[model samples]
Target: MVQVKVFDCEHEKDLEESMNKFLQKIDEKNILDIKYNVAAMVELDEDEQIYCFSAMILYRK
Candidate 1:
């Protein structure tokens, strides 16, 4: 059967670490693919921008 795991973090390094830890418990051969994405947005009243880091892992368990 195919399954997916999703990870999200405020920082890229955090996401990378989280993914690595999860991957360590699973069989590498079962991994089908990984998708990563980032997005940034600023509020109209704020000078700072907010960012989002996310990833998806498709695999078979």
Candidate 2:
């Protein structure tokens, strides 16, 4: 059986940082395949002062 997991994060340092952290959590070092898409988006201000983008990752282990 293949195992799948979802990881999420907000832009604090950088999106790459979030991805790295998420990758570290996965026990399987070798990923068979993976895909990612925008999971959530938020505008903190009326003028779009701040924008937040979250992503969803699908991978097989």
Candidate 3:
């Protein structure tokens, strides 16, 4: 059976961290594909002007 799930996060650093955690929650040991949603977003840090894009990581594992 194939399991699918969506993952999102707001972070100033690497987005991979959230992705990894999200995958684990769904017991996704092997990911098949990732489809990003249109609802994706981005935010800029006022102080540093650093940008962060919201992730809508959809995948099957």
Compare the candidates by lDDT and give the number of the best one: 1
Decoy 1 TM-score against native: 0.93
Q: What are the lDDT scores of the predictions, listed in order?
A: 0.95, 0.57, 0.53
The sequence of per-residue lDDT tens digits that candidate 2 reaches over residues 1-61 is 4655554445645666876787897756455556554444446565454434444555555
Give the runs in model 1 whose Cα sits over 4 Å from its true position: none
Error of 2 at 14 (Å): 4.8
Lowest-sum lDDT 10-residue window in model 1: 41-50
The TM-score between candidate 3 and the true structure equals: 0.37
Better of 1 and 3 by lDDT: 1
Over 4 Å off in model 3, which ranges?
12-14, 22-29, 37-61
Worst 10-residue lDDT window for candidate 3 reads 37-46
TM-score of 2: 0.40
Rank by TM-score, highest first: 1, 2, 3
Candidate 3 local Cα displacement, residue 34, angstroms: 1.3
RMSD for all candidates, in order, please: 0.8, 4.1, 5.5
Q: Please, what is the TM-score per model?
A: 0.93, 0.40, 0.37
